[model samples]
Target: MFDTIDFQALRRIGLSQALVAQMFNLQTEPADRLMRVTEVQRDRLRLHDGEAEHVAQVWPTLRIALQMQGESLVVGDWVAARRDDSLGDVCWAAARVPPVNHLVRRDSSGLRQVLVSNVDTALLVMGCGQDFNLRRLDRYLALVRLAGVAPVVVLSKADLLMDGGASRAEAVRRHLSGQVDVVALNGQEAASAQALSPWLAEGQTLVLLGSSGAGKSTLTNTLTGLAAQATGGVRGGDEHGRHTTTTRSMHRCASGACIIDTPGLRGLQVDADEAQLDAVFDDISSLAPMCRFRDCHHEDEPGCAVRSRVPAGRLLSYHKLQREAQRHEMTVLDRQRQAAEWKARGRFAKAVSRAKRG
Candidate 1:
């Protein structure tokens, strides 16, 4: 908690001109220091106030307000906070600046979860070992696309494969039809960071997203040039890794780019609608117009261009994603309807009581 915080290091964390303008216009407490949250813990948050990081506390009201709004302050969020000299020099955050974009997803319970915000790119890391699955990668691509973040596929653990994972990486690149750049590299090597240098330029912010034991932490350690993240061994049978990194933490690379490392997700439930999913899966989307019927499900439909052109496995993946997206939409609509019905019932009970009292 200090009296002043300048915006000199704001660009290092991908603070855009629009976000600066928004923070400047916000009417908050007497705080000139703008800070970025690097880590969010159960009780406290590690905030970097442009110069240094400080473990700061939050106003109880601030937390309550965010909770009621169904929002939480995540890593990569810029916040306005102040240090009170009168209160024994303690720090307290007042308000959070809205993020430019959010990498959002849903869990198995259909609960909305925002992965990270203010991201410029998503490094979808997948181990070339047993972790290589094109189906899962397609799901990740859709989630990143729906969030409006640029996606870059990173094939880690290349050295483990017989052919250095080149063939596997090429397959992924080909699977996506080269819509995005795919890089195959050994995550433990120093050169791996250089391979991702294009996206690590100054002012760029990236997030590493993959299942547990996909080498996210290894890549992060290499990028930061420090053994800051812990690495664990994978199971021999399934080649699956443990959840070594449990929390989300952001670290600055030597290139001045910021990388946010997250825990390996068990499953990614896409919180997207049909139109949004279409925007990500271009193969099916491009051929849908040529179908005999506009509502062609692509299953046993005569003259279905999508079914004819799309690979059987690829089509199956698309159908599965479509089903999930549709179910998420229905669940959301049901929740809204239930809320409305409850509100109507409350109003009706009040009206009846008023008539009886009169």
Candidate 2:
């Protein structure tokens, strides 16, 4: 089925020569079609093969294997699917094409959840109004950096902010200090969407992440020049927007960039390591070498460049994120130890029962 797709058409959906080569080498049945996952539902998936769109599902066995491997089919995933021999209209996803990069987060239960895969850029959207939160933006940037994707801070609702949101954008830009791109724009305007055109080049994929009232849907509509995703207004008093996007979906833009729209996340926990946090705060990371102690926390330590040089608020936020990452790591370790202890107890009880029987 992939034989009919041309290179130009495939490129529009983020397929490259290297990815095509990988698909060709996959040991799947000849009848299987190579497709990109555009949307994932509870029991079904929407896929595009550069020629047409199809609804597909993973078979029982393949689904079990996907779960066992700790992998999931999210937006921007390329997969191999076979047309059901018995059912003419049905297609079963046989295998997934390995992603070059993926953005993920830990849930309250500590399970990892995949957001978007094979994405080149992450548009960290935040509104200029009450929806803006620097602490949350830091978390999003850390997660995107952890996945090795370029992060662009998108300040939406520019029309609502004072001075066309210039002052606010400058403040955020200064806080970041040339670390990442910060674009402030009205999501409803075409001119604003043009500001983001640089990242929307052909063969590229960008995912939107933000809170419910952050105007992600509006920006997506502006980017695609189509109301592909729904939009809603924030509450009158608090400006908290109702969740406009309930599911993750991808759309191809006129510029040939694939954009993935995600639901406004209420609880975004960055599941990152120490190195990932350092990359997000490179300024502070660079100062760590000048600290007096090798493992200095930078809390009242002598010659602590991080604490002395960086702004107090920014430094505190960095420390908070680092501690958060450390806590997440420790939580995983503790869970593993607890599981081992339970297994040992089970074995000891079994041995005692065997001795009693003897």
Candidate 3:
């Protein structure tokens, strides 16, 4: 299905030519085949092999090796697998190719969860109406930036409203520091398909994320030129959409790029390092260095550059994001401590068992 793949698209998505060449080599080999993961069950993966697809259990050794490295294979990862000689109807994964990029989010308990792997572009889908939230966009941007993936903000359902009529798309562009591209489009329109074509080139991987009823599935279907994903209408009074897509799935674009469509996220916790947060809020970072005191909180501090530039609204937004980042760090640290304690307890139990046996 992905015959006319665009190498340029792959490059734009951050995949090196060398990596593509390696994937090509795997595809050429008859003994081992490369497959894109579609669904991840408890212990088995549902993978697509271009013409046919199947569910196969990974070799125990491969799983252990990946776990040891503190990494995991998520949906949209390219894996090399072959039929096991000893087991019938099972495939043994010999290797997992390095991901070009990944999109990660922290769960409620502050544990990092891989939303999707090997993503080339993260389509930040947001409704042009009431669902437009710049603060939420900041969270998504932080996550994508930390994952080393490019982000494209997509303002969906634009046709329903007037063009550039003081919408959320304009607000997002104003607040975001970097050259983040924002596209406002009506997913049902043919023009929307054309606008998103550049990112859908062969070997590229794109993942969509937004709140429920943000037109993510609709946009996904539009990009593929087929209604492969189901759609639901927004709520009666609010612009919020019902949860339409429950699972993450990968689809191939006409240009040979792959797209991962994900369910709506109720809350997006920022689990990125200070470097990424600094990159996202560069305006704040640049101002901090000029603060008279090294530990200036920008609150009633003399010669605080951040406070000097701030209007009431901008200052509030800046403090909100800063506090959020601090909270995220604290939560992550707590989770790490809990994990360490559990590991120590396990070691103690093992030692006691050995003594008892002796």
Q: Pick the candidate with the highest TM-score.
A: 2
| Candidate 2: residue pairs that collide | none
The TM-score that candidate 1 achieves is: 0.87
What Cα-based lDDT does every candidate model obtain?
Answer: 0.84, 0.83, 0.74
Give the per-residue lDDT of model 3 (tens digit) for 1-358: 1234444433433346646655753332356666667778777887776655677787677689888876667887767777776777777665676776678777786777888887778999988878887767767777787888888999887766866424666676667643698888887776786788878776678889888889988888877788989998877877676778988887766566778889888667777665667776666778888999998877888888887764444456556766766667666678689779999999999999999999
Off by over 4 Å in 2: 1-5, 331-358
Which 10-residue window of candidate 3 scores lowest in summed lDDT?
1-10
Candidate 1 regions with alpha-carbon error over 4 angstroms: 1-5, 86-90, 331-358
Q: Please report the TM-score between candidate 2 and the true structure.
A: 0.88
**Local accuracy of candidate 1 as per-residue lDDT tens digits, 1-358:** 3245454677766778878776765557654468888999888888886567877777688789889887888998888877777656557777888888888889787889888888899999998888998889888888898888999999998888899888997798667767799999988899987899999998898999999999999899999999999998777887666669999999998789999999988888888888888888987899899999988999998888987677676777788999887667676678689779999999999999999999
Give candidate 3's error at residue 170 in angstroms. Answer: 1.8
For residues 1-358, could you state the per-residue lDDT of candidate 2 as single tens digits?
Answer: 3544466777889986667766765657756677899999998999998878898988777788778988778888888888886866769888877777889998887679988898989999998889888878878888888898899999887888668888778878777776788889988888965799899998899999998868888888888889898888777977666677999999987778999999988777888777878877888889999998998988887878788777676777888878777767776678689779999999999999999999
Give the higher-TM-score candidate: 2 or 3. Answer: 2
lDDT of 1 at 358: 100
Candidate achieving higher TM-score, 1 or 2: 2
